[model samples]
Target: MSQQVGVVTFPGSNGDHDAWNAFANDLGVPTRMVDYRETDLDGIAVVVVPGGFSYGDYLRCGAIARFAPVMNAVREFAQRGGPVLGICNGFQVLTEAHLLPGALLRNESLRFHCDWIHVKVENRSFWTSDVEVGDILRLPIAHGDGSYFADDETIARLESNGQVIFRYCDANGAVLDNANPNGSRRAIAGIANEGRNVVGLMPHPERATDPLVGGADGRRIVTAALSALQVAV
Candidate 1:
């Protein structure tokens, strides 16, 4: 049976449809569009917080959305070891909600970045288990506040725990300053929780799942999540 995925839709979310298309249409998985006001997550095997300027990004990127009724359920779900993937602005929300470590600051360029970039898989997580370490993926990123930041001690902990799942890199998997799109510390692009079930990233993997749109590298992530959920069942 196909895994049932839930895609959260905040008031300002713009990537919910894209995520639904990727998982439901392209991957042939069942999907539910969850509203921010909903308080239940009964049948969801996996939850995806898609990218967008939630609450107009008023009081910090995800500060407002963190208090939504649905987020309480999301937090509880994640605490129970459920798989949760946050993309782009969704990543910011996860940080603000304290579901993940680190914060996302404005791009060093002080501008919105929307383009394709390469990211190297650094560790295995539910979202990255299908891809091998050092494998480079072509993914599109669109965000204004995508620079990942954390205290030195927290960074060290994340590194030591193998929680830094992906880092910005060149096609050859070389981490380079020029390849860093948002001046993220250590060129980090994505991370997972200690359990490796919760993940947050600044790139839009759902946007790169279809060949007609661009590349299909992102299919690996969606597929991996499905595989993990199946194995858990």
Candidate 2:
């Protein structure tokens, strides 16, 4: 069975330790911090790219982090069917790496958002496997460029392929304009790659793992991924 999770840390990754705490400390799972300068992922079971303004968000969020030496290993790991989860800025990095499709533009409101939101599960893939479709997940999002955009063709493709994994929705799971916090297209908050192993989302799941912090819904996502990967804690 898979053993340890690897959390990648870029120059400005503020959430690396948060993620490490979630898996290693909170979840009681083993974890390692993968430095961006390192080009290897030797024994890592699952990979997580946490959030932050990598490379100072230079050029664009995740643009520079996409070229980090560690990302090359991540790409290779994905090619080997490894499960990879990217959160917030990590999501941006995956898109910039072409590991996923589309781009995240500035929020439609043009303001940074740091709020709790609801998302409905659209598919059972990788990081979202344990959640049933249409289930409402309450997670926190913190990003200035979380708006998801893609050409109509690409959007349609993702929709038809069931690549859309999470969509902004009301607390009761109703997808509506007001619930679309970042104005993401079709309210998409997360998605999976064609392989269904690479997943990225604009929410911060690691932060919600403990009750003291708020809710434990993010714990659901993490444990779900671990369960799906059959990685015992």
Candidate 3:
């Protein structure tokens, strides 16, 4: 039997069910819904912080959600080397929690962007081992603050450590200014921690897991996590 995956639902989280469906129905793994107030992970092998306006994006995107009780458990899980994937607003939460490096700022366009964009895989992280470097996946991004920013030293460190997992790119896999939807630094769309166990991205992978909705490219991400967990076990 496939191991259980946990999908965390913050107060305003909107993609929790989408994540659960991707893991349970599409990937054939059992899934558990983890409420933001819950303090335990319940033996889940992997955890996903789905996208949405956590705490209504009040003080900041994820500033408030970072203090949720479930985040403490999520932090503990990541500290123990368990894989955690955060999408969109969830990505912001990861940064606020310091689980992942760098911060997401408002888009250079100063407007909310909601469209399909191509992202090139740059390195093999826990959630991207199934994809080859330079492989482009068309994923939908919906956020007003998707611009990734980090200081020169931190950016250099992340690059040197191979923590950059994805970069916004053209369909032909060219990393160019024209393809950068949110003006992220170095066109980065996703990144992982040094251990590669925690990944955070601005795109909504769960929304693309079903071909009926669009394409199944996002399924590879969930499967990669499952493969990683199985190897660890």
Highest-TM-score candidate: 1
lDDT of 2 by residue, 158-206 (tens): 9999999999999998899999988999999999999999999999989
- Tell me the tens digit of each residue's lDDT in model 3 across 27-87: 8776889988999886688999999999999998999999999999999999999899999
lDDT of 1 by residue, 1-233 (tens): 44479999999999999999999899887788999999988778899999999999998999999999999999999999989999999999999999999999999999899999999999999898789998999999999999999999999999999999999998888999999999999999999999999999999899988999989999988887677457645
In terms of TM-score, which candidate is stronger, 1 or 3? Answer: 1
Off by over 4 Å in 2: 228-233
Span of 10 residues, lowest total lDDT, candidate 2: 224-233
Taking all chains together, the TM-score of candidate 2 against the true structure is 0.96
Off by over 4 Å in 3: 228-233
* lDDT values for all models: 0.92, 0.90, 0.91
Residue 19, candidate 2: how far off, in angstroms? 0.5
Window of ten residues with lowest summed lDDT in model 1: 224-233
C-alpha displacement of 57 in model 3, angstroms?
Answer: 0.5
Higher-ranked by lDDT: 1 or 2: 1
Enumerate residue pairs that collide in model 1: none
lDDT of 2 at 161: 98
